[model samples]
Target: MSVAARIAGPDLHETSVAPRSRSRMLALVIALAFAAVGGQLVRLAWQNEDASTIRVSMMSSPANTLARPDIVDRNGRLLATDVQMPSLYADPLLIQDADEAAERLVRLFPQIDVRELRQSLADKSRRFVWVRRGLSPAMAQRVHNLGIPGLLFVDEIRRTYPAGRLGGHILGRVDIDNRGTGGIERYIDEIGASEAAVGARLSARAPVRLSLDLGVMHALDEELAGAMVRYEAAGAAGLVMDVLTGEVVASVSRPGVDPAVYEDALDPSRIDRIAAGTYELGSIMKLVTVAMALEMGRSLDSMVDTAEPLKAGRFTIEDLHPLGRPMSVSEVFIHSSNVGAGQLALSAGAATQKAFLQKLGLWSALKTEVSSGPAPQKPQQIGRIEQITLSFGHGLATTPLQFAAASAALMNGGTRVTPTFMALDGEAPVVRGERVVSARTSALLREVMRRNVTDPAGTGRRADVPGFEVGGKTGTAEMAAKGGYRKKSVLASFIGTFPSSEPRYVTLILLFEPKGQDVTGGEITAGRNAAPTTARIIERIAPLLGVPAKSL
Candidate 1:
């Protein structure tokens, strides 16, 4: 620079301003520009960032994001959902005196345990602590008015059961932390992926439309509840389904719990009896026994020598009301003859009986995941005794749904449709089956089953619907406990179908441990309780299901 300056002489030096002054000016301008830029950057970030995310937390907890999806009935009526509420929390370190804060919090939240609060505060190592959840707006406002230091309020969501105990078992419940703990909640949480959750338009919307109808569900529950109260039943369960679609229109297990207050339920007996509990279905097995025999070659007119009780190794086969005369296949069903069923099953053989039952979808668990019901217990090795017991529904155990579907197979053109709890798409008859029997055989079986209810002196005369052409079979099974059958404890159930001339829907009703009353005619049979319930349900839902009255 000195050499170049010398070449230009004094002109170059004078033209350029003094170095000290130029340097100071440049430094000042640079500093001012940076300050202005920094201010704008801060303003932009403050305006655009999602403040809701940063409001209370930087490192968030899963509990903070806990929210449930919605639950709706088949008709889109809101059955269960969630609502946001204010929750009180505290920064224990910021609190001046833990004792003072505890005293004040107890005044506001009397339900809060003072000892627990003090203990939580004593652990000052904790940065934040939950004071209370599910706070009402009024209570939240009152707490906030206190203006206590270290106190904080956060918005928390609480589950609300809109229909109360109407569909309690189906909808299930969630824990206090806002996670699905049971029933549909657990179902959704399993399928609710993170992407689905984030892209969802509504806040925690998992609207599940079940096949349940509230009107039908309430009606069924009311009838079962009445029987439970009137007969002093230990418990009861009932189900109504569309025979064609395997769609359960109504299912009830009582005494039911209220989902709104899950903690109040103390009766462990309140567990779902139909879906979760399993039992030897008793004479109901006779339906499968007769179906298997007919499917094989034993005809409706085929006769079984029931003139004498069939003798086995040590156990002899008999009937509830054994006819001391030769009983035809139809008589076997009408009389509910155990000896006849066992002999018929033995003649049909275990392989044929197992194949037909397996075809009817009785060997495996149902596909519907709404309940945790056990699978139908398969016959052990299909022996002579096993075949005999299986024939009359003794050695085998099945869920009520399984029993219903198997019975439906006999009525619904011999097609085995997988039972579901979701509504059917339309009225179109979409069949899924392996053709367990020819349509001709099914039609013949229907005619014989009809005689069990419509004909006078039929055992199921109580299940007759005046103009509906009803047909069905009655089952009264003794409760099998850990050791053996329990005396005086019975599961009274009836399985039936309407328009038997051209069968449409199959219905079943079950009453567990119904008490005997003087009004019960000295008998607490399925006919007295479950059969009448089935009749009433059929009368009410038939019109709704679009089944027309046909001249028989």
Candidate 2:
């Protein structure tokens, strides 16, 4: 009886243990299944986060674009902005007939090279290939209607110029990948104002505010365009700069490049003339000569014998409109007497003349947010002939921008003025550059400039705007050829300052290779073309610049 009971008890215990083990195994399997599912979900979440924070290296791929800050004028008018645009792409591996696709695409865009696209699509190894970037909605829809397999669209940020060609030279262009190429666009890159983006994410940073006054810019462009037609000029350029702050309020070059069309900017003939081209600026340089004399302890009444032409080597320096008499320092400036300027420069000698030019920032390269101005082309040797030619601005060639900066210093109470395309943070920093001339000398120069325009016989009389008290000097410089200067193809320029009593803005107007026209009285001189053009510009832009007109 005992043996049988023991055997039965062992069997029951074994059965109970087997059922418990099975239950434990089932629980472990369920736990492992849930763990695997939970891990999969976590991995998917991690992948999404990684995608969102992915950093694209722009240097590695040209297709990787940048997110740039908005560019706005001082008045908050939009100049340039990044807009979302649809871009066409192809999965080369999935494309069935590359040749057919290329042919169809060419029908939609005549600009697309069929052969090149066919080659790009034939590369089945490439997963993605760009067909076209920045397509308009209509073009995108047409491509979509084709229902071509493997053709896809991706949203991309594209640079857009809302002002059209108004401030094109200053606003600059971006490449196909939205990278800054020139002008203030390059400055934005240098200042870390742009972000590299993998996709179509927009920039959320504050807009970059420029010193340009849109109203004034448009006014200047209109005036220059009209002058180009009125004077029959090959080209024209104009700029307005704050005399005290060095801020360039408005700048324009006719035959301007539209920033939206990058190809136009690449054209050599459409380059920015204000800062990119250098020229012998002619008689306007007499202002520098006069300033040098004043700094050398000569007063406005100081007289220079200008009765004869100045001879240096084989070159003779004579006034275009000679007074044929001894000229006072004031008269020399007003008359733009090349003979008197040469004599004054001879008195100062070469070293002093160069020093004065350097101090006025006319002898070196100038840089602003828009560009590093083309370096000044100074005479290699400052000998007698060189000095004479330089006195009237022929031997030394400089960009109009550099010349305008020097003129600004002369009118801003003897303090040096630097030109800038970006707006000042607040009040302009007090100019700390070394004083080039005495305040008294600056005032005297102002008086002479005013007289040059106010006098009925003054060359710049045509530049005068009533109530605005405009004053300026005229310059006509022949373009330098392979060996010498062209006789007829001259660069006519006029630099004007307003309200001579208290100067604010300085304007520079230039006409390149102008021809005789009825409006210009059949003359190509600066007084006939550039001076009157400046007058028109001032009349329109003065009110926009907030310059109050004096009561008649």
What C-alpha lDDT values do all the predictions have?
0.76, 0.88
Clashing pairs for predicted structure model 2, backbone only: none
**In candidate 1, what are the lDDT values of residues 1-552, reduced to their tens digit?**
534645666675455754566577789999999999999999878876677556534443335345566777787788877687777888888888888788888988788899899778766789789999778999988888887888887766677888888778766777776667776666767777211221112254446777788887888788788778767778888777776778777778887878767763445778766666666777767888888877776679989989888888898877667669998999888888888998898887778878877887777776565655678777659888888888877777778888887777788888776677767666676766666677767887798889988767677878777778888888888888889888798988888888888777777777888888876776877777767767777777777667886654
> Mind sharing the TM-score for model 1?
0.83
Stretches of candidate 1 exceeding 4 Å from the true structure? 1-66, 94-112, 138-149, 193-206, 263-267, 427-431, 502-504, 544-552
lDDT of 2 at 523: 85
Alpha-carbon TM-score of each model against the true structure: 0.83, 0.88
Q: lDDT at 420 for candidate 1?
A: 76
RMSD of 2: 5.5
Model 2: per-residue lDDT, tens digit, 193-270? Answer: 999876787899899999999999988999898888887889999999999888899989889999998688889999
